[model samples]
Target: MAEAGEGRYEIASVISRSFETVRSNLGLFAGLALILSGVPAFALNLWQTSFGVNLNAAQPDFSALLSAAYLGPLFVGWLVAMVTNAVLQASLTRATVTHLSGEKPVFAQCLTVGVSMILPMIGIGILLALGVGLAMLLLIVPGIILWLCWSVVVPVYVQEKVGVIEAFGRSMALTEGSRWRIFLTMLLVLVGLWLLSIPVGLLTVAVAATGSVIAVSLVTAIVSALGSMVMVTVQSCVYVELRNVKEGVAPADLEAIFA
Candidate 1:
């Protein structure tokens, strides 16, 4: 275990490590993000845009959007996207953990772990969303607190093979003394992403105005995929840092869990 005051988790360190991991594994991470998130997002955007819904108009055609033709495909696409996202999260978590352990991440191994853990991850996601949503309905502060407390649940489950409730508890324990730092780290990362999206958002609007569905979809997909890649990597790094600071567990030690 970490000795008292021996290891302090630094926000800058986690952010730096996250960027370094993504930079070093750019091809692998990009490929996973494109295939798992980009493609589906593109398909959905293309389908929606093809319907010619002028969302920018003073009054949009809600009736057309409510039609079965629009809602059916959209519902299916949303479901598919959700599953693929779960897989992506697991894959990225595995890759990040392996990379941090001083080993090269194998694409096939990462994919296999992702597929194997999809169902459990999806269940956990639903539970998390419901809990947080309910909390938010009560008070925004409680929701934020719950979110910060459970921020690393996915990583805890992926690395430890724990039950759902156990994973939540573990995350709460890991973040007990560092929730404030965790909140700040995530807030900064989110703000950075939002700033990065501004130009792309403007481009997307311009492209949409030109009635070019394909171009708009492409831009949106790439942006979404890149954002997902960075966020997942950051989350994984946070989990690793938390473990190091709280338990004195090194990344190489985490590798033994897979062994």
Candidate 2:
């Protein structure tokens, strides 16, 4: 296998290493996915499709749609899920970095690192969202371009410990000559996930037909969490490779950040 620090990496290696990392950390990652993503997804879906209905009516009560009681818990859950996902991302970044550096990762320590970094992550996310949203509004091509450029921002932020704004610049710097490669990798990952979801989609339909919203929601959440894990694993690998190429920073250096 080619070393990652050679300023070159095969897509196959990144994918293989990612799977290996996730498999090795499956227990912790699974718990993170379930609590941080799956539970919230299940809860929100169940509330909306099951407990949310007016018991006195055959259909949803249109008048009550805008009521505080209807939206409050759901919104709260959504916010919580958002925060939980950010923390999960940070935790995964830390886990991957440490593991690659030959250290055993602790879930609690990752969680703590995640919690500390949550606010900055949120700030960068909002900035990126607005940038992408505005570019998308203009024509859509620019948005895609921007998306590719910023694809590794979270990993950049988490790994570098730079300021939120600096992370954007750092990502752009690292991705300068490699945007096409990054875009193609992202495209492949998305297409692969979409293909995998076909069977999952059919299963969801079957579950929905059974008239059990909980079952359908559970399946959806699990699939979504799985997707999240795959995406983050790829991202963390990419970030490591990028740093190795651009700065000659080895995995051992990254491990020392947490040491």
Best by TM-score: 1
Instruction: TM-score for candidate 1, please give it.
Output: 0.94
Per-model C-alpha lDDT, please? 0.91, 0.81
Error of 2 at 151 (Å): 1.6
On a 0 to 100 scale, what is the lDDT of residue 21 in model 1? Answer: 94
lDDT over C-alpha atoms for residue 119 of model 2: 87
Cα-based RMSD of the predictions, in order?
A: 2.0, 4.0
Q: Global lDDT for candidate 1?
A: 0.91
Model 2 lDDT per residue over 95-136, tens place: 888888888889899888889988887777789889999999
**Model 1 over residues 29-147: C-alpha lDDT tens digits?**
99999999999999998998788888889999999889999999999999999899999999999999999999999889998999999999999889899999999999999999999
lDDT of 1 at 196: 88
Which residues of candidate 2, in runs, are more than 4 Å off? Answer: 1-6, 51-65, 257-259
In order of appearance, the predictions have TM-scores of 0.94, 0.88
